[model samples]
Target: MQKGSFIGIDFGTTNTSVVRVFNDEHGYKTVNLGEGGDYPFSSIVAIPRQNGGSLKFGRDIKNHREELSSDYEIFTSMKSFLGTNKEFKVGDHRYSATEITTLFLKYIKDYISRTHPDVDLSKAGLSFPVDFSPEARRELRTAAENAGIKVNSFLSESTAAYFANRKAGQAFSKVMVLDWGGGTFDISILELKKNSITETAVFGERVGGDDIDFALAKRVHAEIIKKSEVYNPVAFEDMNLASKDYLISWCEKAKIEISNTEDDYESAIYNYGMYGTKSITVSVNLFNGVVEPIIKSRIRKAVDAALGRANLKPASIDAIVIVGGSSNLASYEEAITNIFKDSQVILPDKPQWSTAEGAALMQIIGGNFKLNNSLGLYLSDGSIFPILKEGEHGVGSVIETLSFSLTEDTQDAHFNFANEDGVMFERATIPTKGYLNEIIRLSARIDDDQIARIQLYNNSMGDLQHSKPTNVEVNKLTFYYDISGLK
Candidate 1:
């Protein structure tokens, strides 16, 4: 482990992974850091319901599954809430998602400390979905720093996975990467150059493996309750959230088991809180019936959207690569195959490790930064001119030369930042300082902390509430952001 080199981290929704790259005169290689030499540790945290309970993670939390109904609180799917800036409350404590992420990262740091005593991880190459905004990135950086690791670079997960699969002398020119994880599904269209892979476009949605688990669990729970003569279906619906979570976890395990086998899979939950002795018989066809629609619809929209933005058709795609833990579903491959009949779809052997490895490979190859959203100024004619294009700038760099001048002498001149849909994220009034067509230089950037900071630069007026711009060097207003989130 080099002192200054970046430690690749896939801080995932369902599981987290860590890797350190060793690069020298020979070349670059990776050393995995996980229990049993595998690249995954459960990404969950458990807190006791009592006022003074210690935080526990990984297997320790799983050991307390039976106590979930009354004794503890479990936090999962926090990664899905990134950039939403929401908070969770228990007793008098309210923890923002960013703070929880920082704690989880700190736990990861401690694990690395214990498992590989010789290695010291400081700087990291953390992977985020392309949809995470500049604000989300900043929040992640803050969390990373709090966890004792400085985020040297933020690589989009799908793009990193693409690089992980790109081989020397490969014939493919264009590839689409699908990352269907527990809490989110991200898709990226990439252009493979003579020697490197470049991400052309990426799109994401909130649907993932967790949704399937919940849906299946609900069905299985209903079946269990129906077997109980005393508890009616309506009454069973009133079961506590903890019971729901427990059932969902059991269903998720069954889902994973079914993905590997070629036949029907059966799982049973014995002696639940209210329902005693209930079992589920899930065949590939049955499981597919529940999840296929979501997989098909989302994959279609994401793949089509990416391909459309990249100006390529289905036939033009050279390969479709699947990455992430939940991508092992047979339906995922089937749906993709149905879409691109002529193209080949690939599922890498170590899908879980691809993104983290790609982050390292991306760093070693000097990859560029890809902004997940578009920042632009809206024109008077309902049109927009873009600034800080995604995939164009280097990571953590600022866009300083994007200056705009007023074309009209109206009082409602607005500067906004948003996605391709033109919905405004945050807006500001251009303080002309009492001049017509004043040059207002706007330097907007996603700082190293992943916070989106837009500085309105002008020699004009200042910061007067109702008065013409007076004398403030910078305004104090910024949008709420940490990682990017999509509707």
Candidate 2:
């Protein structure tokens, strides 16, 4: 935990996991925090500030809810909303998403400091969703830094999952990673030739286990209505209602337990409400029928979309790796087999812990390797405007933003993908032409490849660049900017 500690912090949508790398005489090894010793910390954050009490972290908030003040507040799914650059309200006061996120991360930092007092996490790789925009990427790093955690380069969650799978005797030159976690779902296509791994294409949705839990809760609520005549709908309708939401938390737990042993029919799932008078009972068959179809549909579409982007078919894929907590469902496993019949489907040793583990390993293995090419914008007059400059940047790199409008009727909008030395390799034609003054957005991305690919609909935008250990240059790098749509 000294020089190049190479730790990974997967600040996930629902749960946060950490992994520290170790090396000595026997080469390199990884220790996933949750699976190795103590349990992984939950991303669920609680504060009694709304109730005039002190802040609580991790197990204190989760296990001792009954002891909390009556007007206490807890927040989950912060990762999902962070991308929107919005603020969340707890009680009557509103706080920016970044502020609350920093608060949560500070707790994580304290946890690591207490547990591994000697370890320093200044070079840890931070994992974020593949579809995160440039602003979202910056936001995540800023929050982590504010929390007293030093973040070294970023890793796409799915790519990190790939490294974790490959380390465990997986022998696929080409693999697809199905990263379905608590609040996000990403399908990434990676091609590994020899030792180098590259993320060729990726697709993701802003939905995951948290969404599934809400879906199942809706189904359970309906069942409760049908069974008990004395049930009241008032509790479920209020957004300020914490007890009902707490009941939904119980439903989330039941979803996980049943997902692990889905074949069992002897046990029933139930979340009792208000002195155990009214409750909802769910069966395994119900679980599969209600939520499995949703998982199957989204996952199938994501996998197909990713493969299609890479210009490959299911047969071309050697193996499909499934990771994250939600992916452990027997139904999802069955769905993978049904869709990718030719490809070998691989499950992780600890499905939920792979991202953090692989990220830690990746920090040591592929330190500054670029995943994709840098993007440049070229005008019809043969002038090149480097949108995303082709070079690795500093830790506090400021990603530039450029916007262009279709001032006149134009036919050609060429995009050049190039390397660091003004060498262009690939060109893309954004053949968009219409009325004058039509503004096109350039929401820069450093994460997910596409939500809608090749439809003239850019879900997000990004570039890939490598870094070096030496700090010759600070965050004062300049870009060849042409913010206007003119030549």
Candidate 3:
């Protein structure tokens, strides 16, 4: 109920957290939102099988999981499937990822309203993974709006974590953020000046703690069958949904235990109908063997790629900030430390809540979003005609009537788009027939939604006499740029 308060929502894949921030005499203060001040609860939604039953979310689902039985259908990691054609069904009703997300967000809104009735939910910032497609980003915004929450801004997860951990008045020319969460791994290289933070490069993949949990569950299942006296025990893949879910939950707990303990950890599933009681001790070596491939192939590769794109060496990075639940793994920490031995590595006390807190902080201190890649046209002579240079402009800006001419008569004009490194990422073609020296006007803009739009017009003929250029084969291109910084 604080005046000028804004909320920051980190709607994560496995869990969700909300933080409320408002200015005070000192500066800004943040309050975590949840029942009993829990802040982050599970990002789970459950639908009851019985008719006319209410949908359950987060803590409600976790606390009553045992009673769910066959009467409820549970869904998690819905964030990963947003903007896709994937759907979840409850009885005869089918729900899209956006719909499920809306329901979950509405739950959070209602929960906060109970304690802070005067809090304005409209002014809020949301965090998302850097690798989320344009469609996914749009869908997330739609879901928030549908839930009656106005999204003031969208910040990438790694950037939010950086804002959360960064010290006031501290400056670092080059900092790397390694965010390994439940459903996504994101790496971002940022440049921090006095009051501005700019992202130089970012890389991400759809692999994280959830993946490790599933893999570990399978391994434990195999070990249990081998040690059991019953011949031809049920295969892990053939197990019932409830049994599988239970095993996965156990494995997730064991993964955390293994990370915190040096000794071999015992994982168990007890009194689960046909599964009975089974326990397996997992050695650190075994756990490492199972997760090393993911670490090397996805996590390590993403870090190297981000650094390469930013044209920075490990030693040049002043600090490395590690955040997210999966980052707690000892092996991941060790891998990061080894890779950047010269750089200072920092692990915040509450990595899980960092993104939400940082997002809230962003709402208090405004930031600007800039392009991390250059948008240009590839000329006929194999030369690049730059339209909008990287980091040259911030959002809500436009460039109109930038003049260009065809070098030769052609049926179509090809426009190639590349990142800052000159590696092509997209190509667009506009159909037109014009002689050499004919004028072509190009317009480019970055909207408030962080979408870059480019348009090409055929101004070859003397069409400037009219109110606008002559319309021939007009071509338009659009792409999302996921980078934000302080103003």
Query: Which candidate tops TM-score?
Result: 3
Q: For candidate 1, lDDT tens digit of each residue in 361-442?
A: 5456443334544555667777767766644543455776666777777654566655555756566765455457677776
**Which pairs of residues collide in candidate 2?**
130-447, 130-448, 131-448, 445-461
Any runs in candidate 3 off by more than 4 Å, and if so which? 1-3, 168-171, 229-234, 261-264, 271-274, 367-369, 390-392, 400-411, 432-442, 455-487
TM-scores across all candidates?
Answer: 0.84, 0.75, 0.87
By lDDT, the better pick of 1 and 3 is 3
lDDT of 2 at 94: 80
Best by lDDT: 3
Question: Which residue pairs does candidate 3 place in steric collision?
Answer: none
lDDT of 3 by residue, 442-463 (tens): 7877654455667667654444
Error of 3 at 222 (Å): 0.6
Candidate 2: worst-modelled 10 consecutive residues by lDDT = 467-476
**For residue 235, what is the lDDT in candidate 1?**
39
Residue 149 lDDT, candidate 2, scale 0-100: 80
Model 3: weakest 10-residue lDDT segment is 471-480
- Tell me the TM-score of model 1: 0.84
